[model samples]
Target: MQVGIFQTQEAAADYAAAHIIDVVGGATDPVLGVATGSTPLKLYERLRAAHAAGTFTLAGKKAIALDEYVGIADDHPERYRNVLRTELVGEDKTGLTDELLFTPDSSAPDPQAAAARYDEQIRALGGATIQILGIGSDGHIAFNEPGGSLVSRTHVDVLTAQTRTDNARFFDGDLAKVPTESISQGLGTIMEAKEIILLAFGEGKARAVKELVEGAVSAKWPATVLQMHPKVTVLVDEAAASQLELADFYTERWNARH
Candidate 1:
């Protein structure tokens, strides 16, 4: 595990994008595990810019969303699928073609079977070459909320109140409209990624980032599972690194690498 503390969110995003570009350049049929939410918005924007500038190409790369709401239509604006379509897969965005993008069927007649199929698809694609993540304010990863099983696989997850309330912003401040359940890749599944990058910004994420970086590897802070992964990189702005006791050490490490 490596921690990088950048002066600004844009700087962190740039670092992440550059790293991703390098990984994609060397991998064969890379499949990216992508996360949604505001924390990763800058990274996606940077990736788009890199693609537009000819600094990198998204062609031939595949991607899978980390989770999807169980009860939402695939076309719903707030649905994870549509969100990825608009933000990461659109022709004007990352240029990830529809056929190469995989997401769970939120409205499937048999969601469990669909989840299992999605897991199989991931395995068949050679697992994710890189997994992008955003830690929740409460330290959750994907929809694996606090107290979630550490070894679980793809399955239905009941959204915690905090998660639902946090996601309410995407639903126009209507927490009631947010789906109560979601299908998410499990911790064990995410651990299959060859590389993992977790992005965090703002003071709002300080505690979670601190706990993830400094706390014990416990299920209470689901993101802490990254501590056990062989190749996990954590990038955070100064605000998000505020609560880390080893903030200076991380900064020194990043500076040395640059």
Candidate 2:
């Protein structure tokens, strides 16, 4: 588990984006697993810029969301699908629409069946080619809150109160509207990714980031599971890396590798 600290969001995005570009640059039809929320917004923008520069095209690439809120319409501003469309697909002008983005249809009559098929799509990637992650303030990855099984797969999971509160930043400060339930890819599903680039910023994520990279490996800090993966590149800003004891050392070594 390597942690690299950037001076600002732009720096972090550039570092993370370059890695993602490298992956897409080398693949025929890369299967990318993406996450939503404020942290990844910048990285998504960088990807848009890269695509505009004639770097790579998503014409054949596949995308999957890390989680989806239940009971929300696909057009809802806070919906993960909407977020991805605005931040990633539409922004890139890649002509990648719903056909390319595979997310569970919450309004579908058979949500369980949708989840089952979602698993099959992810498996078709032979696991995710390169997954982008954003760690929650409580260390939750996607909506898989603490105490959830580590080797779990795509399924409905209850969101933690902290996660709901933290996610309120996206819903115009209305905590009550944040969904209590979400269909999320499990820790096991995330671990299946061939590589992962996790981006985090702000002081709010300090403790969770600390626990994720430095503390004991446990399901309580769900993102801690990344430590077990072979190809994980974590990009964090100074504020978010504050609580990580070896943060500076990690960043110094990372500078050498990059």
Q: What do the candidate models score in CA lDDT, each in turn?
A: 0.89, 0.83
Candidate 2 lDDT, 1-258, residue by residue in tens: 667898898999988888888897797678888888888888877778777888756766788889898888767888888877877675356545667898877776776676777777788767778999999888888888999898888888788888888878778889998888888888998899999989889999999889888878898898898889998988899999888888768978988887
**Candidate 1: residue 45 Cα off by (Å):** 1.1
Write model 1 residue lDDT over 1-258, tens digit each, in one string: 889988899999988999998998788787888999888888888888888887776777899889999989766898888888787885677778888889998999998998899889888888889999999999999999889889889888899999999999999999889999999999999999999999999998999999999999888899999999999999999899999998888878878877
Each candidate: RMSD? 1.1, 1.5
The best candidate in terms of lDDT: 1
What candidate 2 gets wrong by more than 4 Å, as runs, is 90-92
Q: TM-scores, in order shown?
A: 0.97, 0.95
Error of 2 at 37 (Å): 0.5
